[model samples]
Target: MALLILTMVRTGEGSINSLGAGGLITLEERDTLIAFQDFSFDTDGWDRAIQENSLPGLGPVLDGSVDTAVERVFALPEETALATIRFDMFLNGGWGREDTIHIILGEIQTLALGWPSDNSELVTFARDGLSVLAQSALLDPIRDNHRVARYSVELAVSFPADRLTLRLVPELVDGAQSNWAIDNVSVVARGPEA
Candidate 1:
């Protein structure tokens, strides 16, 4: 299936109040739970470890020690036709801006996203087998214990697979200072239509 993802570049401009209205979805009784991680307790087997006192109000977040990739794998339901993975991307410290960001899913589906130009809209292109629908919330200040950008991301899945992998790959500027993390992640899917 064609993987779709998008996001805004700046904070509070075209924002949706992360974890508030238009935020992440709450799991209902009817839905099948795939996975959820907020990093409030532990890393929960994620490649990155939980960094305490990373940001205020947001207790702990996954701090990437390895520069390779921050990834998580989930067992998907083959019976379902679609799935939605929602989470937030924290661009912390003093990092340089990029022209684009990529979110890889299941190792096959990928969504390439671009930053907003002069307008309020976040830029994206239909590259390869990807599409975008941008939505973003507030960003943090670039300081110690501050996050430069926090984007609430949602990936719409349209195909079935034995399992799905979600990956956030970042190329660091000053690896020692500039950092990244993901929080309040959850995956939910719908069954095939009759």
Candidate 2:
């Protein structure tokens, strides 16, 4: 039998706050990836308002205090293995109805034991419903009313591989916008496949 160990290789790291925009966050090295505030509405009438409130401003928003980025270490053959990802993310910004966040595993490109792959394959997990833990009531700026406050979500992802690309996406669910923060992303490599 082949013995495998799920170990963490990268954790508590983030990008240089220089790359943030579009609907993607790609990291060349083992760093924390931040999603730039880039969302749109169906109507142009709310363009200005949305841009001001939704754009994920530039800075070290996570700052290690909010999120920890972790990499996984697997003990398997060079080609076959499993990886598990866990994100202990927290929302520390002000409360608003329009705030939302998600941790996404894009795809696996290479099967090597290290990261920084040239090309990768994409795969998505199953998202059935809102995996929420807590909810509060907060003020809504756009609607000018009270909205459901923001909270945190502990997400886990299991896949078969060593190297892959992932991203964190946070958005404003309600018309009233607010900032969202993430912390502690733990990634581990599972044992060999059966």
Candidate 3:
């Protein structure tokens, strides 16, 4: 006789709404999820300098460039219940140990603690209303530079609203050269699983 093992998987049925070029979304169902992805500087919805860079096979990554400060506004559809949101953050030039990055959704803080004092790889926060899925450090060994590290965060939404505002505030200890960039922003709304 032979021993056998089995595993189980579950999948939920829901709708997904993604943000368009103008940061617009249309609602479908009560559990409809929305996500925003901006890879080009052609959109005027974003209020900042959008930079373009080419990769080997990944093509171009149009990023929301922010030297000192910048902000992006997003509006949600009605009859939608938000569940999670996420985005990718990049440190272009270089960042200092004292450099701080604040991720705010509406008026709630999504980052863990305050600013990083020592050089660390990644940081995750466990908090209510919102939670940090992942955060990268300012140092990179393969790039041989302190910059060029990509940080990403995912948050669980407890408060839902019609108009959702997401802002990335970076307090750089260094000069203007140390800039922060963001791209591939997404928001999802879902109902409680059955």
Instruction: Note the Cα lDDT for every prediction shown.
Output: 0.56, 0.29, 0.51
List, residue by residue over 1-194, the lDDT tens digit for candidate 1: 01111112211243455333122355555467676666655666565555565655555666654365767777876686667677766656655445234678766546543333322334344444334444543454535645455666666666657577887666554444556666667778767666
Q: Return the candidate ranking by TM-score, descending.
A: 1, 3, 2
- Number of the top TM-score candidate: 1
lDDT of 2 by residue, 7-95 (tens): 11121122112212112233333232221221222212111121223213221223211122322232322442333333323333443
Off by over 4 Å in 1: 1-30, 98-101, 112-131, 138-142, 145-147, 173-176
The lDDT, on a scale of 0 to 1, for candidate 2 is 0.29
- Across residues 110-129, which tens digit of lDDT does each residue of candidate 3 receive? 66322244444456566665
**RMSD of each candidate relative to the true structure:** 7.0, 16.4, 10.3
Positional deviation of residue 99's Cα in model 3 after best superposition, in angstroms: 1.4
Q: What stretches of model 3 exceed 4 Å from their correct place?
A: 1-31, 38-44, 54-59, 62-66, 112-122, 137-147, 192-194
The candidate with the higher lDDT, 1 or 2, is 1
Estimate the TM-score for candidate 3: 0.64
The CA lDDT at 163 in model 3 is 66
Better of 1 and 3 by lDDT: 1
Over the full model, what C-alpha lDDT does candidate 1 score relative to the true structure? Answer: 0.56
**Which residue pairs show collisions in model 1?**
none
